[model samples]
Target chain A: MTNKTPLVELRNMSIAFGGVRAVDDVSVDLYAGEVVGLLGHNGAGKSTLIKMLSGAYGADSGEIFINGEKAKIRNPRDARRYNIETIYQTLALADNLDAASNLFLGRELVTSLGFVDDDAMEAEMRKIMTRLNPNFQKFHEPVSALSGGQRQSVAIARAVYFDAKILIMDEPTAALGPQETQMVSELIKKLKAEGIGIFLISHDIHDVMTLCDRASVMKNGKLVGTVDVDTVTDDELLSMIILGKHPHQKEA
Target chain B: MSTPTTNRSAKTFFNKLGIDLRLLGMIGALVILCVMFDLITGGRFLTPRNLFNLSVQTASVAVMATGMVFVIVTRNIDLSVGSMLGFIGMTVGALQVYYFPDIVGLGHWSIWILASIAAIIMGACLGAVQGWVVGYLTVPAFIVTLGGLLIYRGAMWWVTQGQTVAPLDPTFRLLGGGADGTLGETLSWGGGVVSSLVAVGLILASRRRKANHGFTVKPMWAEGILIALAAGLVLGYVYIMNSYTIAKGALPRIAEARGIELTEGLTLYHGVAIPVIILLVVTIGMTLISTRTRFGRYVYATGGNPEAAELSGINTRMLTVKVFALMGALTGIAAIIASARLGAVDVGLGTLDELRVIAAAVIGGTALAGGFGTIYGAVIGALIMQTLQSGMASVGVDAPLQSIVVGLVLVFAVYIDIVYRRKTGA
Candidate 1:
């Protein structure tokens, strides 16, 4: 996988807000069928770095390459044009609209007359919800009435429905019970099997160990290091996160 | 247990009817208001003549209220609408009285059309300018429109230097709805039939489409009842308008104008005012834009959650501009109706209409918090407001007391809405 061009590469990305270097000089890469875990504390800048890639924010300096070609992602629309989708920690669902409306928010399915094809969108949503979360039966209810797990399913379903080539999941399992978390872990694995590159932002060591192929740790807005999950123990990853020290550097 | 069960079944019935409970509540309130006023006015309130007048009077404010739905739904208030209406009305008034008569040689058939288009465009430009400041320059809408409220009012005064423009183009005056501004009997019935058919067609089309997608559709009985109710409303409105005969004093002039000999019991029907017709078109069009189109969806989504909408690739800033622009355009239409109806323009043209328009929208169940409002609701809200004022006037209530009552009603309506939302967990 490393021999081929990376599916997405964020090289030397940096962004600042009021002189605070929120995401400073970070580099990460992911290939096809890879899950790259981004681990950090509350203000560790993992979310900020991923936001730039998702086009929610622009980096002061960096390059994002998709399929080894430089990509211009000036906004979320541009990021979508590049087939990149992000499921934010907030789930990003409109509380007043139903599941189908939130599912196809920006890209609504419209009839030939240009009216929103709500029935068609609902039908499509029903199919996707059955596959993603079979227990989700509140299709007609606004997303505000949905449970946390149900909302998470809707968010995940949104990304998967769009055929996103690069999926960014920010704390995907953070708002779930054990069973729901297990379901998400299985979902990540299934998506990985289908050759989609994923950037999973997580604080759980167990999740990164089991779900990600490479774990990248960040501290104080800078990259600590990236390590092969198979080569690193849970304690090693924890130490790297806590001490901001890279064991891989010592090995080199 | 029985109470809860009954409530649940009633809810299910309403849901099956496909009518929003909030809208149904407003309709009920309107009916009750009409009945109360009818009784208080000793049966004068619900008469055809009064209803016709009520509708025509509702047209201008109702049109602006529809636009306010979009504005309020996007979590913005356009305080400048009243002033914008005044300014636009004065501008259109000036064009008809001074510019078009000179250019088109007076009484040209195209004067009304040209003036209307010009008014709409000017309104849109003014709205867009304010929208740009709010959307791009990041100014708060309240402040921007408050500034606009003052500026446009002053601008309205500046037009012709506070001079009242009167004796508007005869054709242009028709847009305001006098006896001449009506569609009359045959056309009103025709319009009513067409509207009823369209209403039924829309209901049927949506049901068939739902079935095509294998969705759970309303039962046949539910569908039939909804169709009947819609048809009845359209036809009933036409019947009321047609029942309103022209004033006996004006009949002689109309007879002379139409080249008809005066006969015993010559009657002229004011089927529907042109302004009312304009309001109807605006209502339907605004509803479509808010519900069926992508722009409408973006407005709601942005209102619901700005961050979420932005992240979903929606250009919320542009959406805000378009929403305000649409509001301004509607205000322009309202301006034409108002000025034309009065056959004159003055600085007081749209005075305090901002409060009335906002009150109507809020009363109609548009949430000030955004992302929730209906076009029909706003129209009904306007009617309710109009009904209250006119009903009070007919019963000889003091003007000051009428204002007090209207103010109380506005606050009460919002309180009811909050309670309803809380109880229903909507």
Candidate 2:
């Protein structure tokens, strides 16, 4: 997988707010069909770093490359144009609107007369929801009526439907129960098999260990290190996350 | 999945109605108000003549309230609408009566058309300016529109030098519903019949569409009742307006004194006001924008969660600007209607309307917290407000007491809305 150009790469990214380095001197890459776990504690700058690529925030200093091509992501629209989409922890959905509206938020399906083609969008949403979760049936209710897992499914379906090449999911399973967590795990595997790159930011070591092929840990405002999940033990990854040091490099 | 479809033990009034709960709540409130006022006024409040007047009087507020629902839904307040109304009214009024009064005398059709277009453009510009400040400059809307409220009001007063402009062209006054601007008896009947047919057709089409989509719809009996009620409301309004006979009343009295026989049944009901027609168009058009357009959805989304909306590839800042701009243009339309309605423009044209407009939107269910509201609700809110005003005035309530009553009602409506939302967990 490393032999090909990465689907997305962030080189030497840094940003500051009020003279404090929130995300400083970090680098990460997501290859096609790979899930890269961005492991960090609270305020570990994982969100800030990923936001730079998602176009939620601009980097003060960095170079972002997609498909080995230089990119300029000045805004969320720009990021979307590059086929990059982010599912923020909040799911970035309009609670007052039903699944169809939320799914097509900025990109609504409209008739030739310029009116929103609501029925068509609902049909499309039904198709995707069926594909993603066969049990999901609450199509008419506003997303606020949906459960956490159902909302997550809608969010995931939105990204996948948009044909996002680089997907950024923040805390995908942080609030789910065991059943929902399992559903999410299955979805991620399906996405992976479809050859899409994903940056999954998580705090759970167990989740990262089982779901991610590689883990990049961050502490304070900088990267601690990246390690292959097969090569590093759970304790080694935890040590790097909390202590901000690579145990394997120190031992070498 | 465990959530109950309906809480039987805690069956709320809205649940009992069993339609779109939010929509039902608004309709129920409006109906309750009309009934209460009808009882107090000895059935005078629901008289067609009074309802007709009330609807015309509410035209401006209803129009502005349409835009306001969007503004409030986006979690933004436009304090300048009243002042903008005043400013645009004065500006447009000046163009017709003072600046280009002679153009119409030359028999050219450009005065009304040109002036209206210019006023709409001016309104859009003013709104865009405010939107820019709030959206891009990062100034809070409260602060920007607050400043605009003062500045525009001052500007309006200064423009007219506290003097009133009057005698707008006959054609221009049509926009305001001046005597000659009304549809009169024949047209009123015509409009009523046409609208009744259209309303029924719309209801049938909607029912058919729902069925086609395999969507659950209200029972046929309920749907038929709703359609009948809607059509009845339209035709009934026309019948009432046609009852005010003009030819036989004062003209007959003079002819009798002069010993000359006059035509017997020359009735001239105050026909449907032109401004009311304009208000109807605005209502329908805005309903479309609110329910069937991306801009409308984005407004709700932006208000629902600013951060989430932004992350979802929505340009909330630009959406904010557009929402305010649209509000500005509506205010301009309102200004035109208000000034035309009175056949004059003065500094007091839209005085204190900001409070009334916002009150209408809030009463209509647009939450100050944002994310929930409807254009129809706002229009109904305006109607309710107008009904209260007309009802009080007819009963000879003191002006000061009337205002106090209106204020209390506004607060009470909002209180009910909050309590209802809490109980329903909406």
Each model's lDDT: 0.93, 0.85
Worst 10 residues of 1 chain A by lDDT: A243-252
The segments of candidate 2 whose C-alpha lies over 4 angstroms from its true place after superposition are B1-18, B102-108, B247-265
A230, model 1: CA deviation in Å?
1.0
Q: Which candidate leads the pack in DockQ?
A: 1
Worst-scoring 10-residue span by lDDT in model 1 chain B: B253-262
DockQ each candidate and list the results: 0.86, 0.69
What DockQ does candidate 2 score? 0.69
Clash pairs, model 2 backbone: B245-B267, B246-B268
Q: Quote the chain B TM-score of every prediction.
A: 0.97, 0.88
| Regions more than 4 Å wrong, model 1 | B1-5, B256-261
Looking at model 2 chain B, report the run of 10 residues with the lowest lDDT sum.
B9-18
